[model samples]
Target: MSELFENYLACWNETDPTARRALIERHWSEDATYVDPLADVRGHEALDATIGAVQAQFPGFVFTPAGPVDAHHRQARFTWGLGPAGAEPLIVGFDVVVTGTDGRIETVLGFLDRGPG
Candidate 1:
């Protein structure tokens, strides 16, 4: 289900509303909640706005997986890097995601590891 996690990152980078929603439907549970240092939101629509806000704040940047996804027992933890395309990351963070029985994300807890200093 690591590929499912990859598509979650893609949802962050996606600018098209329709495609983003579709990805959410495929990857996240209907009641999923996302919590980070900046915000906490529940459900797909809220996740979409949170992601859209991040994308807007970092216009032209892309989010990339920082390393291999380490997953087991329906849960996964991974790091992600965000920055201008092809450049070193300006922001890096880790997130732990848990999936529901249906194989879709149920919760995401995020941490801010590094950023402009």
Candidate 2:
């Protein structure tokens, strides 16, 4: 796994909004695309908005990794906290992010898995 992949996951696990936004800004390109259940966003502003919406909706949400990261493809599967700790995490999705040559994410395809939980 590349350092970026690990760092990206670490950033995803971050709860602080400011820190999380900073991480996204640092790792993703200005023209990055974020595809989630809510919407497909292009550019930093949209990305910020998507994160903001999720933050607003989830409240105490936190993403917990559920499987091995496929760093070669810049992909990962993770479960997320819908409310607080100890509650069953919702298996949000497997995210496949493609990075540009500059090591910034160019696009992300999020596939939601609602199975079993």
lDDT of 2: 0.68
Question: Local distance difference test, per candidate?
Answer: 0.89, 0.68
Cα error, candidate 1, residue 79 (Å): 0.7
Query: For residues 23-106, could you state the per-residue lDDT of candidate 2 as single tens digits?
Result: 888888999988877588898777767777766777766665556666655444333333355666764466777888787888
TM-score of each: 0.95, 0.76
Show where candidate 1 strays beyond 4 Å: none
RMSD, every candidate, angstroms = 1.0, 3.1
List the lowest-lDDT window of 10 residues for candidate 1.
Answer: 1-10
Candidate 2 segments exceeding 4 Å error: 10-17, 73-83, 115-117
| Candidate with best lDDT | 1
